[model samples]
Target: MMASNIELEQFYSREVEFPSPLLASHIKTAEREVHTLLAGMRSILRKNIDPSIEELIVQTGSSYEGLKVKGKMELDFMIVLFHPKFIFIPVTSDYSGYCKIKFQQEQLQSEMQSSKKWTSSSPPHSFQYDFTSDGYLIPSEIYKWFQSLADKAVNQNKSKFVRKFVGNLPARTLILNISPGVDICVDLVPAICIDRDLYVVAKPLKTSPDPHLWRLSLSVFEKKILSQHQSSCHLKALKILKYLREHDTRLEETSQFASGICSYHLKTASLHQLAQRPDTPEGLLEHLHQLMDFLIECMQRRELNHFFIGNPSSLAEKAKVPSNITHGERCLNLFDDKFVKESTLNQARERLVKIKGSLPAIIQQHSGPVAYSCNIY
Candidate 1:
């Protein structure tokens, strides 16, 4: 039998909003397991390639980000290496930094085919690579080094959590099979820590994309923002947004990846809506409505501006802008460059265009109205 609106609302609260304590404990345990393996891996990297890559940043997971379902969690952890050798003193120019990055590009060729998505076509024309001391590496170098470590770990059974090879690309991947049946997989991504204090992040754009450079990934900052959000409504709204997205298949066949729309896009929309509306119980229903409405507008416009991140070059401000030709002519809009690539976005347009019209009925049916208070308050 189908659950009524009240039951559905209760289910969301009991399931997503307040996930079981046992499930929460499991997430924490899984994270601890992932961290233990990464610690060993980091030790290996330090002993082999460079001694400075000491820590891996837990980029996203239920334990930290509050963006996880009860049973499932996606661990997007990143290995950050500090520039091999460096000491910095304040400089008179726009910034202060020391150490030049000498990139190792030889090994990247092997996995270039696998990493074609992140691999860039052309190199950034000009920019001072002085922050090598700040965890940064040539895409290929990071991939090759980590690949060796992961392979060795698996072959030697170095870590108890060692999983078989899930992907060939070394940087953006390396899923660990901590358990059987792939019940728990941790994604180890190699990222250049552009600015740790700011949580400014960039990924290796190897080839098959625009250029070989550091693409912005401000998800950490977004996670931080959501952490400090005034209400848990934002999280609730995000959960529902994801549920609706997965359940609604208006354009199922058009997804570039698993689902046409992604969690990042959904989270981005939810955050934006929360900024305007309060993230309270009374505000959640309207929040979902506004969130979907915003997504529809973005699809109709054929552009979805990244709320937290922007072009990496002009990252001095609160939001970055596209660099001028002098700085590599990076894409000003992150949506255009990263999140939903042109091809994927184009494929999703048909589905997106129809979403607003279909969302109301879907919400009315799936998301019960019992929890919402429509009054202006």
Candidate 2:
């Protein structure tokens, strides 16, 4: 049976939502400290380490997007780089939502000639050693170089934070111990700014034979689209869905499928729903139902189109990719066969069916008589 609007509202407020006053206060304090650390690191990188390349640190991910749920306080930052001597060529691949990073022939020839015996540990003569003989920028090598520089910067600074490297090799994770039992995890990702709107990150496939591929990042556009929406309920609905996805035990049993379902997928589904129904819903319950239904439909079909790919009229305009970038007009399916297996999709569909069937009971169980809350740290 369907849950009543009142029940859904109570469930969302008591269980899914965090107290904004507390969340905001905690986030603000954390952001201040994080900014200080980043500023110190940026200064060192520019003046002492590498003056040839310019770096801009951009805050991204759900924490900054105001969609973060409880028990997750990690922050994401993109170290957007612009080198006067380097030119990146974004090559579209057969894999949807993924591209390869290549260098222009002239730039490669010049760098190769100048630095014949360049080493990673040596002073920054040029970035020639980070690329392959064929002019392709190796993702792992570049990541390592950036990591080394970040390590040096952290060491030079006399801050009270202890840094560590975690997660995938593409990014560096810094764990800042602010106080007793309060540690903030910051992920610093290195990216090449192709244009004002377009960025190619050094993210590579976990198991792919080729490690030179760079993933396209639409984080800037996503923030713009999400912020432009007038309805607060839309954002609330997305948060509730993310909380459910993170906490659900049925989905957890299918580990592969659950891992495959990223927060971006939920956000994309919500954006599509928002586009379909432009008018703001009357309440949070209505919006949450609409978003869940849309997500289930996407899972059942085993297809979710990337929000920004091939839609030049609407999302593409929002993306603002330069005409010279040359991303093809074909729709890029988020659930490409190369990335997600057929069996995993079948398992995901079945699990979602069961989850939707008992959603009300799940909500009731989670929503206690008193509202649930957590400490920020």
Candidate 3:
């Protein structure tokens, strides 16, 4: 038996939606604390570590998107480097979503020489040791430098509210313990904003052939799209889908798959669905079912394109694309070999089917005289 709309609505209200009062009070407080910590860290980096380096901190990911479900308050921050003396070199077709970066030494030297500003100590620490002899920026070396600076900042931070700080190098993450049993996982990514919509980060996949290749980041554009296009029903459906992906044991078994169905993949699927059919005022269950069907179809076919890659009109009416990036010509497949294995796709398909099948029972089990609080803002 299919779950009734009322049952589904009740389940969503009780389980999926993040409580609004808590979000406004507690989550917002935590967010402010995190921002304060980052501000102090940035100051320490500038004053003590690297005087020439400047960083612009940007919050990204599900938490900022308002797609975060209950019990997960992790935040993502992009520490964007404000160095304009770097050039982005697009990698070969083999690495579609990655690019290699190089220091623009020749251009900088020429310009500085012309202006009589070329001094023996002009080039900063990054331009000196973070690049290879051939001028290509080495990802590992740059990450190491940033990591050391972050470590010093964390140690020097005088905020007694932050109980503990843990630095994860390989994943480029920092875990902060704010209180007992409550920890916020902050991903401090080092990125270079190539354009308004395009950012290349020092993060590389584990199986990447060349570790120096930087992965592309479109978090800012993604946040804009979701904010502009997402309706109440659309946001609820996405939250439920993310909750399922987090709790599904079968999907967890397929963790060996390099990029097995990340939250971004699910967000991409929802965006595609929204593109095909613009969200309406109602039909939460219908939209949820359609999103599941869309994901299953993509898994069966093993092809899900990155939303902004091939589609120029993916952006909203007010959004503008930069002249540097040419959309529609270059497409990135989210389900490629580097992303997911066939076995992982098959398992995810099966798991999604099981979840869809069990929805009725699950909803029925949670159906009771529960107060409906309109708290998803």
Candidate 4:
């Protein structure tokens, strides 16, 4: 049976949180450390290349990269390095679009290495230079300089607390040990600023075969949109959906559908729904039903068309991007075929049928709730 309105409401109050108070402290702590670390890096970079502050830009304001999910506190900052030598090309593929950042090696290594002390620990992961592959400085390679960067901060009369951030084996994405038992993982994405405001990044795409391809991230614009229209209900609905995916055994463990479904899907669904009908306390259930219906249909069909709904990227960027249909089939191929013998998709379908059946009793408490229709086949 599905969760009832009362049960759902109670769960929402207990589990689903918006701008979760419990996590605020952790988020603040993480942000503070991140800024400090970036400052340290910037300081050392200045000493080495001694370039003007304008060349290396740290984009981490509200419009820049940061996550809104209440469950975990994740912060993203894109470090944009602008050099006349770098070239950027935005490309479209079957799954998504990306902007390729390419640069020549002739002047980069010598020009940036004027300060020899910094290069001793991590010698700029310029393996891209070794191969014929035309490559821009990748972010993961840049992360290798944390120790030297952190040391600069220590010597320059900043807190010694930042020392912990360095000296770790740099992982793919840097995970800093903020404080005892409180740590935040950060992605110091390296991108080349394409236009004044646009950037193309090479963040590894797990869903695509081309993991190293540069993609356009409208993160700054997306954050701006959330700031403009985010309502309590929007975050609440996303949390509950995430909770269901995480806790409900049928959804989390037993369903093949769960593998394909991600927190991003749930969050984007809320954004699209809220844009159409601004959410309210009384209408929370209605919004949830809509999201559930879409999810069910998506799972049944084994194809959920990604929505560019209210994309905050510029019209020019949008103009260059292709329709999502190209990527949708590639995404659909990740899961089991819906009709195959003892198919996981079929099993997932059965689970949704049960959830749909339970909704009647689950939502009976809402006053004259709208009837929800689902294609359970």
List candidate 3 segments past 4 Å from native. Answer: 26-55, 106-126, 131-133, 166-171, 250-259, 280-282, 314-318, 323-329, 363-377
Please report, in order, the local distance difference test score of every candidate based on alpha carbons. Answer: 0.49, 0.66, 0.66, 0.48
Model 2 alpha-carbon drift over 4 Å, by segment: 25-55, 104-125, 161-163, 206-208, 230-232, 249-257, 280-283, 313-327, 367-377
Which run of 10 residues does model 4 get worst, by summed lDDT? 368-377
Error of 3 at 214 (Å): 1.2
lDDT of 4 by residue, 50-149 (tens): 2212335344422131234333334556666545556655445443445455665565557447635446575553333422154544433444443455
Tell me which of candidates 1 and 3 scores higher on lDDT: 3
Listed in order, each prediction's TM-score against the native is: 0.65, 0.81, 0.81, 0.62
Worst 10 residues of 3 by lDDT: 368-377
Query: Candidate 1: worst 10 consecutive residues by lDDT?
Result: 90-99
Q: List the residue pairs that clash in candidate 3.
A: none
Candidates' RMSD to native: 11.0, 4.4, 6.1, 9.2
List model 3 lDDT by residue over 1-377, tens digit each. Answer: 88766877777777777676755554465566656756665676543224234435677887777787655556677777755567788775667677888775565445545655346876543353445446777776667777776667667775655544445433356554556555556667777788776787777666776767888787787788778754557767878777667545433445322236788888898887777777465577887888888988998899998876645654533355542343533778888877787887887787777777787764444333322211121
lDDT score for residue 245 of model 2: 76
Model 4 residue pairs with clashes? 2-358, 4-362, 63-220, 94-326, 94-327, 95-327, 98-215
The segments of candidate 1 whose C-alpha lies over 4 angstroms from its true place after superposition are: 1-8, 14-23, 42-51, 59-63, 86-137, 158-161, 168-182, 199-202, 206-212, 247-258, 278-282, 310-331, 337-343, 346-349, 352-377
